[model samples]
Target: MRSGYSAAFKALLTRFAHDTSGAIALVWALASIVVVGMVGAAIDYSRTVNVKEEMAMELDGAVLAGARFLASSTDIDASKQHIVDTFTQTAALAIGDAADLKISPADVTINETEGKITATVKGQVQTAFMKVLGIETMNVSVTSQANYADKYLEIALVVDLTGSMKDPDGSGSTRIASLKTAAKALIDVLIPDETSDRVRISIIPYSQGVRLSSSDASAVTDGYSQRCVTERVGSERYTDAPYTSEFIGGGSGYMLGRTLYYMGYRLPDLIYDPEDVPEFYDRYGDGLGACPTEEVMPLTQNRKTLLDKIDAMSANGGTAGQTGIAWGWYTLSPNWNNLWPTDNEAVPYSNEETLKYMILMTDGEFNDVYKTIDITEKDCPGYYRRGCTSTTTKTWWYEHYNQTTDSSNRAKSLCTAMKASPANQGKGIAIYSVYFNPTSNAMAEATMRDCASSSRKFTYASNGQALTETFVKYAKEIQQLYLSR
Candidate 1:
């Protein structure tokens, strides 16, 4: 009986041990499967999130690109296409250029609503782990918006239509023609508005002198005029001669115009007065005014008229950059129709709304200089050659006709005068200077650069295209600023 009981106990214990072993093995297997499944899902989920994030970033960049293109776009479909194409290209490049991630539409449409540019980018990003779960792709959609800046602009184009500009040799009929194209391009970018006259453009073409329209003469003063006299060779002593105009008092100084140099003569001088002569210098030659023989026109905005004048510009005169720059300053001056417009805030010219700026361009050095030389009985070189002689100069019989008293120094002085004008205090004006076909007159370049508001504003354009490009850029930049303001 004892042996049988012991055998039964051993059998029961063995059976219990086997059952526990099988149950433990099954539990271990289930736990391992759960851990593996969790890890796999985590990896897949993280990948999808990462790809979505990347897609979102790509879409954001696309919106900005699209908005820029849209700014100049005149049509909607074209703008939208540009946005989408950008998104597709960037999306592909971002993901190893994989075919899996792509904007099916390949075009994002942008709309301007309430003064904002808005765009939407849609694309599909293929998932790694999600694909194992039978989900091969995820859609990404993003929207972006950029606010528009100012819209009303006032633009002033300061161009160089000087004698040198008309040369086929200097810039090949290239300067004026390129100027026309660039000007037209700038005009096209004007983005006009009907709600309010949003943009106003003024064109100023200058060379040795700036020619103004007769109509604007009523608002202009003799000080800003680029006139002529019966100019001829002479020393600094006979520089201020009073000569009668071949035409009349319209202007008695600009006898042959800046082209006087080409005609083998000197620029005319103002008449000297005993009171006009300073110990060494005087502002307006004699305190009265220089004797001008050339036609002195005033500022003009008329398109056809201005264009015609520009077409007729011939290169023949010495570079009087001072007068050219002065005219530019005059065109931009708020004091045009007022004595002291800045102080009289109540009735200042409306043209002052835009920023005052000037672009001074020159190919040659300064040739024209005005100084008060009163040849009294004691200082007169000769009876007729002593005082201010209009028709001729002492040099006609004595010195070189085109002899300048240090032209380089004269250019520097003129530049300083323009920059230091009472009306241009605290840099009230922005200046852009160009050195086109410069001579050995190093001071000429220095004077222009020093007077400019920025180094970027100074340029050395070799050809006509470059010459026109400088001014055209100024016009466009001003146009942009004007429209924005």
Candidate 2:
């Protein structure tokens, strides 16, 4: 009887072990399902987040367009419909047939009294694997608001017209050509209808120096004949101080002599005979004559004038970016308003109703800087006696001119002061810098980076198309008034 009981117990133990193995297998199968479901949920969540982010961006764009339209449109219902239509089209392009995409005219609100437009977009993205976990769809909703503040804008487009701009961009087009096209497009958007007194643009094309009208140059420098001028020196170098006679002579002597030398004429005391001078002088090589032929256009509301100035731009000179930056500030400075036309005067820095912007664009380094020298009797004894008979002392004069600080440093200093003007209630000029450098010029990039108001205001373009796009983007941003969440 004991042996029979043992046999039965052993068989029962064997059956129990077999059942335990089957139970372990069933548990693992259930865990596998759970693991797969978790992974699928994670994927669906990621996709939903991406779609939502895209929707948010698209919504922001839609509202910006709506706000711009509302600024000009008198019909509120029509503007609202335009906003809805714009969203639908952009959504189709960005989200690609999102489930239950919904944007109606009611979703866009227009406040005429406040000059504001707000828009909302709602949609759902169908889930693939989350459906198994009872989440059939993920909802996405985004709202964007824009204010058409109607504030006046004073913009300076400081462009590089250096010799390198003659080089072909990545798209096989000259940089100057691309720049003109892009700049004209910007003018079109900002000063639409050519009758907008609310927006004024100044074109400052600079090379080794910025060109002024001959009369303006003379006025600023107390009879400096050259149309081009370099960076100012002394206490008011970076300030928007009125160009009075006291400050005008600080840098005028050097400019006067240099301009005369490059124009194939010598100073009255140095020249033996004025009739011997050539009518034209080749002013390349040493960058002495590296002044852009394109003269600066002061703040103007005329779209045609702005466009024409850009079209007439020709590139042939060294890069003097500091001069460009200085002129950019001057154009928007109220102190220099007297230099411009009465109707084109810049609004005061204290004016809360005006927004000032400077777009500083360059393709290469700030390699040119003006130097000053005091030539005395000892330096040129013959000048006091018989005067210089030939160009024998030209090279010597060039070498003796005292060099100033680094051009890049000067440019950055000007940029800093412009962005932190003491006069504008602590809110100064907004600077946007564009570096169109396909060659990856590190120093140029660094200088431009330092010049921008913020990281978001700096842009780099490696090709002609990209350069144009950057200009257009900044133009749109500048015209947007103000945007918020």
Candidate 3:
């Protein structure tokens, strides 16, 4: 009996030792710890990502605000403090403050030469799950860069000084008044102050054509020898080449065979100053008064001078958009750099560092251009050697060969030339054409649209405010800021 009991007890102990249920329970307990850790880690990582995204957005706004503040504020320390304080407030509002969050004034860097501002925000997020594995926190960082580079800008304002510009549209407000206001506003925005050489502006007011000052005309002549000038001949008419003249002797300092240098000569009726029109009496009532005789202002950084020129502009001439386009291109072309003042010389066409722009405004269709026409001895009056007088006595002078089509075609050709691709004499000129005429002349609109670099570059101002708004819009675009990174 004692041997049987001993044998049964030994068998029972062997079965208990071979059992695997306890091992399975131990394995499940170990797996549970790892699973819980992974789940907590995912939750903590997601929270960190959210915080990082919020921090980045807030930091961008803070940097831009800082940059704008820096631009206006002279005190560097105050500006930097303001930037950091702004970031601190913005980030706290965006995400809960972490113990490691930090943004010092030294983190903000301003590079005036590069026209850039850089700001960085660094912080660490404490991880709940990761801390269990000996990890205390994970780093979170964001950086923002704002570029307000003062790019070298060369702007040509080709505005219509035509008599029609003086006429009040249905609104009872004159287009010329609106134009002056708009142009002055642009000048103010672009120049801001007179200290910077990064920007320069040239004014080319066009009527029957662009009026060259006596000095400019003489500059085109041989040693100031000639005064009588003619339009450009052959393919040279479409180019910005300086006018070439042959000296006709008489000590009269008269220049003949002079092709159109600066948009042929201004007509008689367009004379804004009485002192300027020596032959006003002869040409009075000749056609529609005359073209403007106002002197063109070359690229200049003087804010006062540019504003004064705009204010002094008067309305008195027929429309000649083609010549306006030509002079606009010439104003920004390096080929004609010698004609401008040394301080405002044009950069080379291949210069990628500079930007060239043309803003052409017109209130009427292009109607006048210099064309050779046959005139009889009686009508010639001998005082005029080649061109016809702006008078009814010689109606033949008014009717030049395809005057209407030719003038419009000339405008189109100039537009094409100005916007020509990288090839040819095309210098990547950005043309912005404004048609202030309220009336819908399909042909005129089409011509003006074709003149623009793109549809966005063309604007139609139905009223005075619209015109000003258009100019303000363009000013902002020309002097805009961007984010590089």
Candidate 4:
């Protein structure tokens, strides 16, 4: 039996060991193993691909964060921190396993060009199954950038409703009427949302000065007394609007009209009453009340407020733009009190993400100002050849020239200060100055240009149509600045 069994085992071994005859089965077995290995590899490859995709997405987020940080500040360290933070957050979300593995991440490269930021990143992901085949890890990378842009904006419109704005339009519509139509159109473009506090506009209709709404007027000072617009039969100022104008406060050019960008706005209660004369004169620069026909309204985000104010605006009063400019700047300025959030708490200024701006329009030259004849004559440059021409009190043309040295200097100084003020220094607040029906007796075009943020920002309108277009153009430019960061 032992012999027989040994012989049988030897025979079986010989059969299994046969090279030619048994080779086919061996080949078949090996082929099966190969197929199984391929299948397993496919599953692992799919998982690795998914992991790579997630990593790429995470890298994208990291890049965007870096770009946003750059947009907010010029600090390199801050941007780096933002990049790292973003990458870390994304990495956490992308990493799938609880087991720690070696991770190699590329350094964030920030490329700033032409006021834009671009970010690039690279990283390597370890593979679980693929590593068994001598592959240690998979390489993955991605790049992305944010425009670092400003999405929304806050604009303040300080319009001159003086008699000049009433100049008849060639289309039969008066300058004021066309202005209203144009202003309404501007509002349509300005407010993506009627109630969105995203952007707020304050309308100041002034002849000699701006008139705040009854609410604003009462708050600034004793509105019951010294209110110019409500009481003055000829005044066109809107009391409900923010008090003051660049001109009224003793400013010149658009400097007197653009009070919002620099001085910001002051509450009515803070200013003294104008009607009280000697007692109020000290603080009278705040501005007068609106005429019976004067439009009275406060800083409102509603489209209706702006449209209605434009419609109700009527020409009256002497143009005192100095006070107007100071007030306009006051309302929008960060320095103002009680005008901030109702909770008296600070909020992140988002769309205000970029800068603030103001568009000032006037139909006529500064005919009414605050300085003496000698001062006006000296400051007029070439514009006031009549008044600031000489120091003599008996000048022949000084009386006819309304632009006083005090007002001219005030406007110039206001412009210089507004553009250079700390709050507005880098705000890039562009001032567009429009002088309609420019007279040789008034400030020259060059002087007007000087009153603006720059030559590129100032404009002069020789006619009513030009005046309308000028304002429309100003609105368009400001809109672009708001839309593009």
Query: Which one is best on lDDT?
Result: 2
Query: What is candidate 3's lDDT per residue for 1-485, written digit by digit as tens?
Result: 99999999999999999998999999999887788778888988897888878877888887776655543334456656777888888877777555644433327887767778888877778788876666677788888888754456778999988777877754668888989989988876676665336677899887665556555655653332122222343566766655542211101111111232123332221112334444644344323334355667788878888888888998874665676787777778777777777886777777765677888888867775654334454434333443354442322212122255677788888778777633223556778888887776766777778888899988888877888888877866666557656
Q: What is the per-residue lDDT of model 4 for residues 287-317, given as tens digits with 9 covering 90 to 100?
A: 3322224533334567766776787777654
Stronger candidate by TM-score (1 vs 3) = 3
Deviating ranges (above 4 Å) for candidate 3: 1-107, 110-116, 120-144, 169-172, 221-231, 245-283, 286-289, 373-379, 382-402, 421-427, 483-485
TM-score of each: 0.50, 0.66, 0.64, 0.47
Q: Model 2: per-residue lDDT, tens digit, 187-223?
A: 7677656546567889999876777776777677556
Q: Which regions of candidate 1 are displaced past 4 Å?
A: 1-122, 125-132, 141-155, 168-199, 218-316, 337-353, 370-427, 438-441, 468-485
Candidate 2 segments exceeding 4 Å error: 1-66, 69-113, 118-146, 245-279, 282-288, 376-405, 422-425, 481-485
lDDT for position 359 in model 2: 92
- Taking all chains together, the TM-score of candidate 1 against the true structure is 0.50
lDDT of 2 at 25: 93
Most accurate candidate by TM-score: 2
Q: Per-residue CA lDDT of candidate 1, range 1-485, in tens? A: 99999999999999997787788899999887666656766776676567767766776676655444433334556556766777778877785556666555444433344445555556666665555456677777656655432233333455555444444525445454555654554444443222123334455554334443343332232332223321222231112121211111122233212233344432332233223345322432221223211233233323444444444433434444444454444444444434223421211224333344555666555554432222333323331233335543332211013334444454445446445543323444566777766233566567667767678888876665676576667655654321110
**Candidate 3 lDDT (Cα, 0 to 1):** 0.65
What lDDT would candidate 2 get against the real structure?
0.72
- Return whichever of 3 and 4 wins on TM-score: 3
Please give the distance, in angstroms, between residue 227's alpha carbon in candidate 2 and its true position after superposition: 1.5
